[model samples]
Target: MLIKQIIIRKKAQEIEKKSPYILLFHCSGLTSRQWRQLKNILCTFQGRTLFQPSCRGKLPYKKKQGGFIAQFAFSAGPTCILYLIRKTPDNTWSQLLPSAFYKQNLVLLYGQLQSTLVNHMDIKRAVDLETVSVFQQLFELIFYPYNSLCFCLNQPIQAE
Candidate 1:
């Protein structure tokens, strides 16, 4: 199974030069190593740009869950910048104010709130919350500026 997966990935990489943007979404519990592998494969095959965002919770086997979170946005050049965010344990949302920093590179946002922002399909439009605290924090981060073209991947029942 592993060998077959690798072979398929190599074939995919060979053909990625034709696609404009490749958006990948993974569940919340992936390790940094797995994310790195996916990033490498995408970078190698797609020959375009790649971005991966950290989840709200700590990845399994990771030490710190909420500090120096690394986010990426790739372009067609040799230079790349690692956009870092600091997650607070207090559950307060710290707005990473958009600057001229992220003017380029296609921004691909993930997470629950991202779905509503991208597709305009509000979950809250369907379900109501009586005492919503964390939901507010989540929304603030998702609906912030500079994240106009967000895309949400369907959440998997089990982490891959």
Candidate 2:
């Protein structure tokens, strides 16, 4: 469920009082100095913000599930990924996306997750196979298209 990239259909400046705010969550795996990109993205949204304090733990998942879920990255090992979430009115979301978004973005992203999972775990364990399967399942739980605003948007949005 790692969020590799954010694809906002609208420009940051377009967010109005009625629009949902985009909250960028940078995982602890991301160093403080590396937040330049996240900062830029935030600035595009006019720099409105709220703060929550979280420090990394040496034991990975021992104390960071909240952060991991927020950023969609697993805090299991050295492997880390960039990620993003979009909030739209559930109509223009998909229409605004490229045709091959799932194929090009999601499929490739899942492949990377499997690759990283292989690197982190001791495959010799009998449960590793199940672990991978569950990972795929949970991954879907996080990024399922059905949950997206643009899940089914063939019809045009009617203007108010």
Candidate 3:
């Protein structure tokens, strides 16, 4: 019985190691299909598998089932940026910067915000002076191209 348990564990480990998780995020108002062209490029690469989410903004697989290994985006070139949104003590939403920088090849930028009223979906219809101002600030901080991708974890970041 002990030997069988050990063998089962080993098989699970092997399955986990077989594929690296890659998260693809498209800019606001765009669908995950924004990465369709890039997916074609990555599919040709060796040892890479593509998993499309059943619904937009929803991850296809659970994290414990081998969480994402890397995040990829196409800008001027292949770039990876980590964006974080955190609730502040002032009872407002704001962006947080990563403590450590990413690799030179990876191209990660960091920025912070004091507060914002709009969440993800509402950014489009943010007509209020304050909401529109916050939206402008976000775009200025991270000028995500129409077809670009972003990386975020934990709570879902809005994308069509």
Give me the candidate number with maximum lDDT: 1
TM-score of 3: 0.22
Q: Candidate 1 residues 99-149, lDDT tens each?
A: 312332223223234223222212122121111111113233344422322
Error of 1 at 153 (Å): 8.2
TM-score of each: 0.29, 0.23, 0.22
lDDT of 3: 0.29
Poorest lDDT segment (10 consecutive residues) of candidate 3: 126-135
- Give the winner by TM-score: 1
Candidate 3: C-alpha RMSD after superposition = 19.5
State the lDDT at 7 in candidate 3.
Answer: 47
Better of 1 and 3 by TM-score: 1
Per-residue alpha-carbon lDDT of candidate 2 for residues 1-160, written as tens digits (9 for 90 to 100): 1122233213233333223322222213443333434444443443343232233554344465444333423332232222223433434334323432332232111111332322222211212121111122323433543322122122232222
